[model samples]
Target: MSISFLAKHPVPCSLFLLGILVLGHGAYIQAKAYLAQFLIAQAWQQTLDDQQVHKPWQWADTYPVAKLSFVTKQESIGFKHQVESVYVLAGASGRTLAFGPGLVLSGAKIGEVGNTVIAGHRDTHFANLAAVNKGDLLQVEASNGEILLYQVVNTQIAHQSDTQFMAPSDDNRLTLITCYPFNQLSGGAEQRYIVEALYVNKPSAI
Candidate 1:
């Protein structure tokens, strides 16, 4: 098109350009997220199979730490049904959370006797948590092939200043933490949504 034509059709041309930009931006975001998930899944597989840290890429800063699974039950009969799982990385840094949940190294190991805290972005890996409730069962599969079971005991919302959630406990526990008000789009949320689970039993190896 000539400069004169574009100038004469400024409004239509501008609208068309804006539509293209919007579509391009949306596609880019989706593609980036899909690629991240794929790499994270590959690293998780290697970690589980080799029982060692596995980075998604040559120079990646994070590695898979554990695999977490939640069983979805039927609402009518209350029978166990589908199960969904996700790989957890080592650090809770922004870079790590972009791919999956992160394990707090200072906390207890997956099968140990202390509070094991896992943090994830509310809108990503932890999004399904909103459907979780008390009594739900969670299976934490360690890199060593030991599967530890946990029963959700409670769910609460606490201020960001509350350190009780992170405190050490005598009994085995698993805590899932995410920013409160899951629907919020802003950063630095002052509250957190906590899901606490108690150790149940460790079944036979997989």
Candidate 2:
């Protein structure tokens, strides 16, 4: 039926149509959030939490860097983990090595003896991450059940060409990365935003 004709019908019909539109939009958003959460949690469980197949790096171990599941937001699903590429140290143009949804980048490795650098996709996997603010608690779930806590220290923006954002620091650090101009349209993100956190003492796992 024509929309205008339907609108001319009884009040009940108009109310019902409005209800459908509202409910449908609500359902779509809820479903999308659930799916994102499920995908990320599953990835962490299967790859990082699998006792028989995977083990996290020891606190004393160094090198390739330990991949840990990062959870925040106090939400059912936090976000994906990623591995930091040592090559990010190599002149900045090389692609930073990373795995999606299941690995935490060891910030202790990016510079000569400084902050560890890590990155994640902003649109699908780390969208809610933009909500993360300074002082938000972050947990890095390792296979050993030892979850490390980090406190957000700062957040900033950098161009795609600004490699200094990934430069190693003198202090122990954690950097969470996602595409920037957070309000921009989907097709082309013009910049990048980074949330830097400091490694506080280890906290109990959630």
Candidate 3:
């Protein structure tokens, strides 16, 4: 409260300030991520309307390429269901993943019969991937207004360096990749959680 008190307990005061800074930074990051998604959603709407790429922000280097959705609940054919979705950006760079999942540039095209790879932060966008299981359904709404359906066929964890699952393939598949150990707060995780889904059908015509 006073200079005397701070000087008397410099270590404690310093630790207290450090703690506040850390918490403030974390809060700022979360706020930014949430706000960015709202803007990205608007841009996605424009892209869908014009069939063109639209950046969420003027300074952003990425644009929405697809919308990825995961079926959260399906009680029965007669009942309604719930789904969770996030916009996929153009490239999987660190800057891009901070806001939403990003599409791997080297991977196959979004709605095509190939490996469509996407990466997101475990704590944010792809956090739900941890609950996903084989046989679950995933949907991709491409920029062209085409909705493609996919059924999860596998879920695996591999070392971060393993890139086999992310490589391009001839079959119609969707690969969702996120860091392993979803609870970990640090950015560098040594493992990866991957959800692989196969193209099942076109839920509707564009």
Candidate 4:
């Protein structure tokens, strides 16, 4: 309809404008995520192949530090296995987490003899963590080309005030942390869902 006509029909015009705004916002969110993933994937591949730090962009303060992967069993008809991989960046800040999980700097380096903690957004890269169970195997490919294996030992929900989650340890461990209630869409989630995995063995490749 013409501008004058739309102005005359206030309710319908308001609804139409709101619809457009909603759709536009949704598209923007999707586009941002797609672009972030695209750039992160490129950096990840470069890091893996070159064994060097690769940033998604020149201005970015962080780079892909490791690759995380796990195998899942499917029971559709017969048993099938599917492998999923995600690149972990060097920082867990807002900008870094917009794309993928980030490696906490204070934590132990990947494949090192201490706790390695990684954090990701619950709604995005870490959504699959809800499906992880004890005994599930995970692979972490360090930037140095070492592939370390870990098995989930347990899962827990802890308050954000808990300092033990970030504590250093003597034994090797990998901890994946995401906001609790994976389905929540709000920001500043208070509780964390933690997946603690024990170091098992090193593999040739992920």
TM-score of each: 0.88, 0.50, 0.83, 0.86
> What are the Cα lDDT values of the candidates?
0.84, 0.53, 0.86, 0.83
**Candidate RMSDs in order:** 3.6, 10.9, 3.8, 3.9
Per-residue C-alpha lDDT of model 2 across residues 2-52, encoded as one tens digit per residue: 778776886878788899999999999889656544543444355544543
Residue 202 accuracy (lDDT) in model 1? 36
Compared to the true structure, candidate 4 yields what TM-score? 0.86
What lDDT tens digits, residue by residue, belong to model 3 across residues 61-179? Answer: 99999998887534342212446888899999988888889899898989887899999989888989989977677878989899887878889999989999988788999999999
Cα lDDT tens digits for candidate 4, 1-206: 79899879989999999999999999999998788778988887888787777888889899888889965633332222447888898979998888789999999988989999999988878888999977677788887778777877889999999969789998999999999988888878899999998897532222
Best by lDDT: 3
Model 2, stretches more than 4 Å misplaced? 1-113, 202-206
Candidates 1 and 2 compared by lDDT, better number? 1
lDDT score, candidate 4, position 177: 95
Best by TM-score: 1
By TM-score, highest first, what's the ranking? Answer: 1, 4, 3, 2
> Which of the predicted structures, 1 or 3, would earn the higher lDDT when compared with the native?
3
The parts of candidate 4 lying over 4 Å away from their true place are 73-80, 202-206
